[model samples]
Target: MEVAEQRSKVVEAYIQAFEDRNAEAVMALYADEATVEDPYGTEPIKGRDAIYAFYQKAMDLNARLSLDGPVRVAGDIAAFPFTVRVTVDGKRQQLEVIDTFRFDRQGKIIEMRAFWGPLNSQEI
Candidate 1:
């Protein structure tokens, strides 16, 4: 399969796992030494264990994720624009984000960076 196509599949699996709230499944798509820098500026979570913990916490919040647009793939990279809906303290909120992933030769995500900010979130 083409690299772009493989990367697209990886991104698809990622979205599916995240929406399913299966942190283990999500972590399976990442490389052993993968790094995730969610929301862009915060400290990056490195390695599978840390990444797993990060996803665990996020999934525990019961957030629902949906694709906002098509997944863009170039070479070994994929960029997914998505929306996350969550209820925090009984207040429903929606966050628009673009997450970019760099995949390894084996199709595992090596790096993930989520782009979003306070302005990207709104009450829903």
Candidate 2:
């Protein structure tokens, strides 16, 4: 699927922010009232402050993501699949993750949701 030209830029910003571990940069990609559903088991986290906390927790994992393929935009939303390689509790793990992003008319992400599962069946 083809990502909207404008939204593609915003997605790039998100990936760059993640790679940099710059919370502020990550927040910039979202609107003030943006909602995120990372680790989807929990309720959707709303607003920039909550989103900041989510990213902060992720940063604590010392995580880094390698995205696959271009962003797939469908209407006002887009999705990109990624694999995160991180070391938590002295063990390295690969996580297969899918990130879905929603954008407002102005192109700022109004909502960003992420879900993931362990690449290996071994329980952590």
Predicted candidate 1 versus true structure: per-residue lDDT over 1-124, tens digit per residue? 9778878888888889988889999988989989999978999989988888888988999888999888899877899899999999999999999999998887888999999998999998
Model 2 lDDT per residue over 34-63, tens place: 888777676988877778988988887888
In the order shown, what is each candidate's alpha-carbon RMSD? 1.0, 2.9
lDDT per model vs. reference: 0.89, 0.80
Q: Alpha-carbon error at 58 in model 2, in Å?
A: 1.0
Off by over 4 Å in 2: 1-3, 118-124
Each candidate structure's count of clashing pairs: 0, 0
After TM-score superposition, what is the CA distance of residue 31 in candidate 1 from its true location, in Å?
0.3
The alpha-carbon lDDT assigned to residue 86 of candidate 2 equals 82
Model 1 lDDT, residue 78, Cα = 93
Clashing pairs in 1: none
